[model samples]
Structure formats: C-alpha cells, structure tokens
Target: VAIMGRNKKTLDEAKSKLGNGAVAHQGDVTKFDDLDALYAKVDDKLGKIDVLVVNAGGLTAAPFDQVDEAIFDSMSDLNFKGAFFTIQKALPFLNDGASIILIASIAQSLGFPGMSVYGATKAAVRSLSRTLSAELADRGIRVNTISPGPVETPIYGRIGVPESQIDGMKDQFREKPLLKRFGEASEIGTVAVFLASSDSSFIVGEEIIVDGGIVNI
Candidate 1:
C-alpha cells in the first residue's frame, strides 16, 4: 500500500501504522507529474499496483451566491479533475484485474443548500466511476464508488460554516438517520476493503451508499 498526500506528518504516521505493507509518498493528487513520479517509485519497488483507492478530496460549503470562482475551481479541480487523472495516469501501472475504488459522497444525489459545488464535484466522480468501468472492462479492471454521508472526519470543521453553527448542523441529522448517528471513517474504510478485494469481483460501476439511510429517507 502507498499513501499519497502533501502532509509529511500524516504520511509518516500512516507509514508507521501500516508498517512494511505501506510506503508514504508526498504528492498532490491534482498534479499528474507528481503522481506519475510516485507511481514510478512504487512500481520500481512493488512491481505492480493491485488496488487503488482514489480517496483524496476536499469540501467547501457556502451559499451559491457567496461562492467565488476561485473557491469553485479549487474544489472542482481537486475533487473531479484530480481524481479523474489519478485513475487515468495509474492505468499503465495497475495490474490487469486491479480494483479501483472511488470515495464519493451522498451529497452527489441530494440538494444540500450550501453544498452545491461540492456535490457537483462528487456527482462527477460518481459518473466517472461508471464511464471508467466501461472503458476499462476489456482489461478486467473493476471501478466502483462508495458514497458516505456525514462522515465524522476533520473535513466537517472545514465546511465554511461558523464553528458555533456546526453543532446545530450535526445535531439535525441525529434523528433523521436510521442509524441515528454520524458515520466513522473506519466504516467507510471497511467498505473500501471489500471493494478492493475479490469479494466484490462481480460489482462494477456501482455506487454503494453507506449513509445510515440519510438519502434513503
């Protein structure tokens, strides 16, 4: 396993926790050249990539009128453009029957007031999963997406809402979900593991929504 990110500290921690099975490379997903270099290094060491989880993303929430071009472009470029190219560039290095899992979001299908741009980017990711799955079918590469809602990640603090307003936003979902709680990152990770393994070999171009029934209701 290889971890890609701009944060050296986080990468170091991942390297330590994942041990010999993991290698840490500092690179930005949006930059194809950087990703290419990382892939080169990994290929030189590991020979071939059997699984890829395009898990890098960001979220920016603001009123439609308040969203600026810079903000919209930043989110779209990182979430959509970055993710699309990451898979495209990794094609040569991926094994013949590799599994590719994209981390998407339930917001892609729902209209959350301030999440328009963020949701649009995630929607693009979901679409990319289907199209890429078809494109890579001849090679037996499996492409699928996992959509999680209200995951308890540090990202929620960066939702462009006032710190004081975040608790209220989180509280609103408590009773609305069938699970009656937010999801943990580990929950998403487990779904990703299944998708990456042969257990999900027959699944392709599918979006498994693990949102605690948020969108189902």
Candidate 2:
C-alpha cells in the first residue's frame, strides 16, 4: 500500500506503521504536477494498481453567509477537483479491473448548520462516482463513494471544535442513526476492504454509507 499527503511526518509515520512494503510520498493533492509525480513513482515501482483510494479532502463548518469565493475554491479544489484529477492522472497506472473508492461525508445528505459548502463538495463526490462508474464500466473499473458519519478522528479539533466538547460531542451530535454511536476508523476500513476486493464485484456506481445509519433515518 502507498500513501500520499502534504505532511511528511504523518506520511512517514503511517508508512512505518503499515510496514507491509508500504510507501509514502509527500505531495499536495490539489496540484496536478504533484499528483503526476506521485503516479510516476507508482508506475515505476508498483506498475499497475488494483485498488485506488482517494481520501484527500477537507471539511469546513460555517454558515452560508461565511461562504466566500476563497472558501469555495479551497474546498472544491481539494475535495472535488483534487479527487477528479487524482483519478484522471491515475488512469494510466490503474489496472483495468481495479476498484476506486472515494471518501466522502454524510454532510452530503445532512442539513447540519454551517455545512453548506462542505456538504455540496461531498455531494459532488457522490455524483462523480455514478458518472465515473458508467464511464469506466466497460473497462471493468468500479467507482464508489463511502460516506462516513462522525467517525472518530482528529479532524474535529482541526475544524475548531474544542476538545472539551468533543469528548461528549457524540451524545448530542445527531438524533438519527439507529446505531446511536460514532463509528470507528477501523470499521470504515473493513468496509473499504470489502469494496476493494472481489467480494463486491457486482457492486458499482453505488454509495456504501458507513455512517451508523445516519442518512437512512
């Protein structure tokens, strides 16, 4: 497995932790040249890839009034445009029968306060999966989106949610989701593994929501 991110330290640590010939490259996903370089390295080292996961994205929580051109561009560039080119540039390196998974968010369906821009970005990701699935169907490529709801990650703090509140945030996070609890990263990983493997061979252009039943409610 290979990982690419802007943080060299994080990438190195992840590579070290996932020591099964995993490699890490530092690059900004929003840059095409960086993505090209990353893929060049992949092509030279791993040749054709069977599974590609595009998890490069960001989230913002602010009222619609706060949505400005800069905010829109930043979010769209990273979440939508980045995902688009990440796959476009990887087309050559991707194996014909491979699976591509995109990490989206429950924000796509949720009407949470201050989530207009973020939600719209994820909605684009969800829509891309469908169109890409049809566009690549003849090539045997599967494109799907995974919408994770309130997963346990360090992102909340980055989003300016105070740690004190984060501790008890889950209880009042949302009133839906039959599971009544936040999801674990590993749970999402398990589902991703299933989607990437032949087990989901028949599944295509579909969304596998990993949000503890958030949208279903």
Candidate 3:
C-alpha cells in the first residue's frame, strides 16, 4: 500500500502499523507535480498502482452570506480539482484492472447547514466517479465512491467551530443518525478496501454510503 498526505508523522505511524506492506510518501493532494513525483517513486518501488484512493479533502464551513470567492475556490480546488488530477496523473501507472475509489461525503446529498460549498465539492466528486467509471470501463478500471457521513476524525474538530461547540454538535449528529452514533474511520476504510479489492468486482460507478443510515432514512 502507498500512502500520500501532508502529515509525515501520521503517514509514518500508519506505515509502522501496517508493517512491511506499506510505503509512506509526503505529498500535497492539491499539487499534481507532487503526486507525479510520488507516483514515480512508487513505480520504482512497487512497479505499478493497482488501487488509487483519492481521499484527501477537507470541510470549510461558513454561512452562505459569508462565503467568499477565495473560500469557494479553495474548497473546490482541493476537493474536486486535486482529486481529478490525482487519478489523471496515476493513469499511466495504473494496471488495467485497477480500482479507483474516491472519498465523498453524504453531505453531497443531504441538506446540512454551513456545508453548501463543502457539499458541492463532494457532489462533484460523486458525479466524476460515475462518469469516469464509464470512461474507464474499456480499460477494465473501476471507479467508485464511498460517501461517508459524520465520521469521527480530526475533520470534525476542524469544522470551523469552537472545541466547546463540537461536543454538542456531535451529540446532535449522533441523535440524528439512525444508528445513534458517528461512524469510525475504520468503517470507511473497510468499505474502501472492499471497493479496491475483487470483493466489489461487479460494482462500478456506485456511491456506497456508509453513513449509519443518516441519509437513507
């Protein structure tokens, strides 16, 4: 497995946890040149990429009236443009039957306050996954998305809210979810693993929601 992100310590920790099966690289998702360099290193070491998970994205929440052009552009540039380019740059290194899993959010379909720009970017990702699946079908590469809801990660703390307010927001999220709890990163990781493996061989261009039934009901 090859991991790409800005957090070198986190990536190193993940690599240690995965033992010898993982390789860690520090790169920004927003830069195609950085990704290309990482891809080159991976190719030299791993030969080819069999699975590409475009999972780098963040939420920038603000009231619609307060959202400025720079804010919207930053969110879209990182979430959609970065994701699109990651796949594009990895195409040459990807094996024919490679699986490409894009990480999206249930916010894309759900009406949530202070999430319009973030949700729009996720919606674009979902749309791209479907279109790319069809476009890459002839090459036997499958493109799909896992739209997760309220996963308990560092992102929750960075939702443009005070730390004091996060617990209350989390409580409300749990109550609203049918499962009565926020999802774990591992849950989304499991879905991603399945999508990247032959277990989901017949599935393509589908947005699998691992949202604890928050969006379905």
- Winning candidate number (lDDT): 1
* Candidate 2, pairs of clashing residues: none
lDDT of 3 by residue, 85-138 (tens): 999999999999999999999989987888899999999999999999999999
Candidate 1 C-alpha lDDT tens digits along 1-217: 7889988998999899999868789999888889999899889888799999999999888899999999999999899999999998899999999999999888899998898899999999999999999999999999999999888989879877998778988998787899999999999999999999999999999999998999888
Candidate closest to the true structure, highest TM-score: 1
Model 2 per-residue lDDT tens digits across residues 1-217: 8789998888888999998778678999899899998988887777889999999988765678978888889899999999999999999888899999999998898787777888898999999999999999989999998999998887877764466765655666555678777889999999899999999999998888888777786
Clashes of each: 0, 0, 0
TM-score of 2: 0.94
- Flag clash pairs in model 1: none
For model 1, what is the C-alpha lDDT against the true structure?
0.91
What does candidate 1 score on TM? 0.97
lDDT of 1 at 123: 96
Better of 2 and 3 by TM-score: 3
Regions of candidate 2 where Cα sits further than 4 Å from its true position: 161-169
Each candidate's lDDT (Cα)? 0.91, 0.87, 0.90
Ranking by TM-score: 1, 3, 2
